[model samples]
Target: MSSDNPTPTPGGPTRRPSLDETGELPRFLDSATSDEPIGNVKPEGDLAGRRFPLTTGFSALVRNRHALSTLIRRDLAVKYQATVMGYFWSLLEPLGMAFIYFFVFGIVMGANDKDVVPGSDASFVLYIVSGVFVWQWFSAAVTQAANSLGGQSALITVMKVPREVFPISVVFARFAEYLAGFPIIIIIAATFGHGVFGWNLLWILPAILLQAMTLVGIGFMLAAGNVLVRDIQRFLPLVMRMLFYGSAILFTMDRVSDSGLGQKLPWVTYLYEHNPLVVLFQMHRAVWIPGLAPDQVGIMSATFFAVIMMFLGRWVFYKLEPRVLKAL
Candidate 1:
């Protein structure tokens, strides 16, 4: 080599990134005017960003089921852990609520005027219990989803996993707890001999699918909002309370027919059909209670709403996720 050949430094440069003595090696063409990365390992820059589409989001959510399921189980454990009895409270919640509704609707006002009685033929309890079952699940999902982000602030602030997963998992956790009471519902309906049976009973399955979709969508949206607005957690219960009475849970929608204003009410029918949660309640009644349930229109409407709620809610959640950590 010629004497002019470049001499290597005796003590080489440190492994850390920096400008060379001549500021030449590994330098960019626009180094003087740019803030672009000059290191081998640049920041991922808002890693875990939301650039994926709806399908990808859902697929990712599904893949994270273990994390989701753990949260759900933890919630259930925490819920009963504070109470006197543990799992028994699950059945007690609906049963206690059912008794209250029974007194108010069935006994207090003599409101079981439609002969909505329970027997080997057709049970009123089953009709009412079906409503309780579906409503509890829907309400749980909604209520939990709304508070999910706020509740998981610690996890959100520290964890590397998806942020949306926290709220979505909360919804699922509540759902799993809500479902724990279902076998009791089915048994009550079956024991009285007033149950509807056979292949037709399967129709409730579709309504359930619709209801689940609706809950997930609404859950994500509520969870996102709850993170930003602390008041939402308190306000959501009030909203669900009103919805419970208006949702046609204890009594049939036909019960409103005697009052012309409620009967002639056009939107009532629309809400009944379009709200997937309501539709699931009515669907369970239609399949479980023999010779009851007016028509299938409500279930159809609910299915439609479920589809709309799911897509829109998911979009909103994805849109909000990037800012969620900051808000939390």
Candidate 2:
């Protein structure tokens, strides 16, 4: 007579576990489910390929905060471990960019003669350096986050940790770099030509928070999209370059707003004012110089945009996360 039952593998069943059970119930269910019930059962074989919702993604991140923090520290340490200058390179990079932009634009192009900040004592050098410092933080965070997933394939494939942690870690690590360079900016602002300090420096709190939110949103979208289309990785640098020039990094938004181009096309003013980076740069400069404040309307608009992008990007990341892992 034929055997009634097929033999199991040496240790267990031959078939793989359901992705829902493998991914969700055991880890996310125990604590988070106490408040919000999770009805996700072991998904059937056909349905197991689908992605989890945003709730699951957020829960995973919250549960893994310690691991996430460790990853951020490890990423930062590994980046500069063997280097001579080490963390000092972070300060030098933006400082060097400030000098180059100051020479080429402020000195050679005579931008120094024009007053970007009306009635403020700050000079072109101060303006460029302040903007460059913040821009470097934003660019480096988003770029590193975009590559975070692809770069940590070994970890992601083997570890039970949340994938979102990888991109979020990149954002935090780059923010650390920004924090490292901040004191230098303060000294430069105090000592350099016409740069001044005032109570407005408190505005930096909101600016950093808003910019961090914007970067996290960008990180989510790019990290997931890069997995599906590797071409996104190749094209990202070009996109960053376009954003750099378009965002008025070297000059002030007032220059754009008051320019002939801005006069002819009112949309140019609308566009720059609505941009998160423009709003951020304005806030940074306001903090560094007295008698300057970011446009209230622009700040409001950018904050709203940042919130939308944050939710939308998280949705996209969680939606495609399964496909991303499968492709890898």
Highest-TM-score candidate:
2
Runs in model 2 with CA error above 4 Å? 1-55, 290-292
In candidate 1, stretches whose alpha carbon ends up further than 4 angstroms from where it belongs are 1-56, 113-120, 262-276, 290-296
RMSD of every prediction: 13.5, 9.8
Candidate 1's residue-wise lDDT over 16-124, tens digit each? 3332333332221212223433222222345323222222466656765665665666677777877778888777888788878877877786765345533336656
Give lDDT: candidate 2, residue 243: 89
TM-score for candidate 1, please give it.
Answer: 0.75
lDDT (C-alpha, whole model) for all candidates: 0.65, 0.75
- Among residues 3 or more apart in sequence or in different chains, the pairs in candidate 2 whose N, CA or C atoms overlap within 3 Å are none
User: lDDT by residue for model 2 over 101-183, one digit each (tens)?
Assistant: 98998878778634666666677777888789889988998888888888877455444566788888998898898889888
lDDT of 1: 0.65
